[model samples]
Target: MAKGKDVRVRVILECTSCVRNNVNKKSTGISRYITQKNRHNTSSRLELKKFCPYCHRHTIHREIKK
Candidate 1:
């Protein structure tokens, strides 16, 4: 198996507003962003403020289970 330390991991950040407001009810998915983080540097779940195309605004995006 590969070493887990100091490895870059892939994660998805989803828009908070869109989820809370229930925007895009017709769609079967929520707005999400793909990004990577250093496992050693930041072990905690990553949260970022990013623009959501569906919501058309900047919102706090929290990492979701892959």
Candidate 2:
């Protein structure tokens, strides 16, 4: 068995308040909330929210690659 370097996991958080607010604002709405700066550093090992395929929802946890 061997470890793969190319494989990586990402966490994506979905805030309900933010999502609703953005939807209401229309033009300047989306940009006002979400930002590229919020994205997690791939190299960091911090727990975060990610889209889960099994649960069909976003989950907050640490991602591991086998």
Per-residue lDDT of candidate 2, residues 29-58 (tens digit): 221111122223455544555554433456
Query: Model 1, residue 17: what's the lDDT?
Result: 78
**Per-residue lDDT tens digits of candidate 1, residues 1-66?**
665653898899988777877754743457899999988888898999998777677889999998
Stretches > 4 Å off in candidate 2: 1-45, 63-66
Worst 10 residues of 1 by lDDT: 21-30
Pairs that collide in candidate 1 are none
Query: Mind sharing the TM-score for model 2?
Result: 0.27
The local lDDT score (0 to 100) that residue 13 gets in candidate 1 is 92
* C-alpha RMSD by candidate, in order: 2.7, 12.2
- By lDDT, the best candidate is 1
Q: Please give the distance, in angstroms, between residue 9's alpha carbon in candidate 1 and its true position after superposition.
A: 0.4
Clash count per candidate: 0, 1
Can you give the TM-score per candidate against the true fold? Answer: 0.78, 0.27
